[model samples]
Target: MKLYTWLSAPNPRRALIFVAEKAIDIDIEEASDPDNPGQLSKRYCEKYPHRRVPLLELDDGDWIAEAAAVCKYLEALYPDNPLFGRNAKEAALIEMWDRLAEWEGLMAVSEVFRNTHRLFVGRGLAGYDIQIPQISELAERGKLRLGRFFNKIDERLDQNEYLAGDIFSFADITALCAIDFSLSRKLIIPENCCNVKRWYQAVSERPSAIG
Candidate 1:
């Protein structure tokens, strides 16, 4: 199996970090567009129509596109570390928190970046080559939503060590990547969110986080 990734991207980083935490051995390919540098390569786009990063190409010629799905595939194959949780209840909790982190935090951060960054001026949305105009109002709204997300997570973190509970699961990984990605937009944990700051410090110190 092979994993195609763009290390600079936050979504791909989540998968990469999960792999590191699990200590899985797999062929890893760094993806890049020869013509556009940071964009997906033309040949890669042709091979994978969806054109998503952190893609997992199976030995059976099957492919998993989403980053979380990629991690799930890997976890099923290598279940030693058990990032998805060890039981049914744990799995549901992890999945629920992971979805919250992805939609509320990561998507919000991407919303601001896609609509405000010059690199995405004409391509505000991903997975398409067509011109999709950026809306400045969306960026402002994203910032507001992200702020609310941070506050909500802060309250949750106050009672537990990790996003889903006491265990450092995939939800923590997604939330970590989201918070780091938000830094590019000058968005950060509010000073009043002491619990979030504490959680960030602990998670960022992990060896997997460096990957």
Candidate 2:
């Protein structure tokens, strides 16, 4: 198996965290994509039609795209670690919160970072090129939504060590990547989220967080 990875991107970081937690070893190929050639290239698109980073090219010539799907495949292949959960119902709960974090939390951050950050003008996954300055109003609008989700997550964390289940799961990994990515954009946890702060500290202390 081979992983197409990007160190600075949250989506690929999600898979990296999972591989670390599960202790799975797979060959990694860094796809720079600076010239937009990586995505538009016929070679990569033949196996991965979408041509996104974080794609897994299996030895059998099957292509698995998307961060969540790649992680899910890894979890299934390595069942002892059980990041997704032990059973269907337990897995569903983790999936519920994980999806929420990905959509409401990570997506909003990506919108701001991709459109507003000058560094991503042509280097982004969408293969977009050109200078696009930060739109304070647009970014703040997304920030408000992210703020609400963060508060809700903080409240939930106050009641449990993990987000969806008793054990560390996918939701924890996804949320952690999102929080860590905030360092690039200077997004900090608000002062009033005591519970969230506590949870973040705990996650920071984990050995896998050394990345």
Candidate 3:
């Protein structure tokens, strides 16, 4: 199997972290130029029309696009580390928290970055060539949503060691990536969010995080 990824982006970082934690030995290929955010090579665009990174290509020629899906596939193949979960209940909890992290945390950061960054002036959305105008209102709304997300996660983290539970799972990976990605927009965990700060420090120090 081969992993097509862009290391500079948060989405691919999720997969890379998973790979490091699992110690998977799959071949990796760069799908995008790190300096150029959304510009995909003609060959890459032709092969994967979605034009997204962190894609997993199976030896059989099947491709998995989303970051979560890519991690899921790797987890299935390399189940020893088990980042998803060990049981049905754990799986459900991990899934719920992972979705929340993606929808509430990562998407919020993306909204602000895509709508306000000059680099994305004519391309407000991903995986498309159509010119979508940036909306200042959306960026403002995203900041509000991001603030709420940080508070919610801090509350949750106060009661649990990781996002899903006592164990470190894929949910934590998503949340960590989202939190780090927000830095580009000058968004950060509030000084009073002590729980989140502690959680972030622990996760960021992990060896896999360097991936």
Candidate 4:
């Protein structure tokens, strides 16, 4: 399998952490910049219709998009050192929060990045610039939720080293990436969020985090 990636994207970082955690060695291909028109060129778009990075191209020629799905596939492939949950209840809870973290947490953070970030210059067009009244309202609500999310995760981590359970699941990596991205993209919890800050430090120190 070959994984297409980008250097600085948070979405790809999700897969990066997963593969690193599992110590899975797969062929890596760097995707051309999304900002560059070449991304949508015939060759790349054929390999990945979404025209996004972090694509997993299976040897059979099937392509897997989305970071979570890629993580799930990797977890299934290498179960000795697991990242997803182990059992039924564990799986449900872990996936639930993972979905929430990706949807509510990461999505909102990404909006702040793509829309508010200056690097998006020519890219932040129609879909990127469009304002949803709900997200705008939620952006305010998200500020409070961000605190709650941090507080909840921090409290959880206080008891166990990882989020979801004693194990370090993808949820931890997802939350970690989201929180780190928030520093540059959206409203970050100030240093006063002691537990959150402490938890982030731990996550940051992980060897996989460098990926």
Candidate 5:
């Protein structure tokens, strides 16, 4: 299998971390420059109409897009590590937290970064041909949303070691990527969120967190 990804991007980082945690062996192909969308190759764009990174091409020539979907495909292929969950209830809980991290954390940070950053002026939204103009108001709203997300994360970590529960799962990966991405965009985690800080430190020490 060939995994096409941008090493620095959060979504691709999630898939990369999943592969690292599972010790999966696959060919990795860097697809495009995240800062410059025009660098994406025509061949890759043909294979993935959405023109997004973290695309997986199976040996049999089947293509899979979307970071979470790629992770799910790998999980099904190699179940021993079992990052998703063991049972139905656990799976549901993990899924809930994972979605929260992606929507509340990752998406919020992305809204601020893409809208405000000069490099992404007309490309606020990913995987679309239409280029939306930057909205300062939306960037402010995104920052507010991300701040609340950090507080909520701290509260959850205060009760559980991991986002979903005691065990490390996919939710942790999503959160880690979100936190790191936010930090890169100059959104620092509040000092008052001690639980979140501790959790971040612990997760950062893991081998999978390394690029």
Candidate 6:
């Protein structure tokens, strides 16, 4: 199997972290930057029409595009270090928290960065052809929503060691990537969020986090 990914991208980082946690070895291919029209080679465009990174190509020639789906596929293949969940109820809870982290946390941070950053002036959303104009009002709203999301995560971590519970599952990985991505936009985790800070420190020290 071969994984197509970009080292600096948040989505690919999530997949890399998952692969690291599982201690699996897979060939990796870095995708060229789509931002540079000259560098957007025809071969890459034909292989990945959506122009998204962190895509997993199976040995049988099947391709998995989304980050969550790629992680799920890895989990299913390597059940020894199960990150999704062990049972039905645990799976549901993990999925719920994962979705919350992606929609509330990751999407919020992306909204602010993409809309306000000059690099994305003509291309705000990902995996789509339509170009959306920057909206300062939406950027402000995104910042506010991100603050609330951080507070919610801090509150959750205050009671539990991890997002779903005691175990460090895929939800924690999702939150970790999202929180780290916010730092690039100068959205530091508040000092008052001690629980979140503590949790982050622990997760950051893990070997998989380095991936």
Q: Give a tens-digit lDDT track for model 4, residues 152-185.
A: 6666667766667777788888898888888765
Better of 1 and 3 by lDDT: 1
Work out the TM-score per prediction. Answer: 0.97, 0.86, 0.95, 0.81, 0.95, 0.93
Q: Each candidate's root-mean-square deviation in Å?
A: 1.0, 3.2, 1.5, 3.7, 1.7, 2.0
- Which residue pairs of candidate 6 clash? none
Query: Of the candidates numbered 3 and 6, which has the greater TM-score value?
Result: 3
- Residue pairs with clashing backbones, model 5: none
- Clash totals, every prediction: 0, 0, 0, 0, 0, 0
**CA shift of 47, model 5, Å:** 1.9
Candidate 3, pairs of clashing residues: none
Ranking by lDDT: 1, 5, 3, 6, 2, 4
Which tens-of-lDDT digit does each residue in 1-211 have in candidate 2? 9998864678888888788877887898776645653334445555565656688988998888888999998887888889898888989999998999888788778766765766655443353233345565656766786788789898898888888967888888888888777656888888888887888888777776666
Q: What does the lDDT read for residue 148 in candidate 1?
A: 94
lDDT of 5: 0.90
Badly placed stretches (over 4 Å) of model 6 are: 34-42
Q: Which ten residues in a row have the lowest lDDT in candidate 5?
A: 33-42
10 residues in a row with least lDDT, candidate 2: 123-132
Clashes of 1: 0
Best by TM-score: 1
The TM-score of predicted model 2 comes to: 0.86
Question: For candidate 6, what is the TM-score?
Answer: 0.93
Better of 3 and 5 by TM-score: 3
Best by lDDT: 1
lDDT of each: 0.91, 0.77, 0.89, 0.72, 0.90, 0.85
Question: Candidates 1 and 6: which is better by lDDT?
Answer: 1
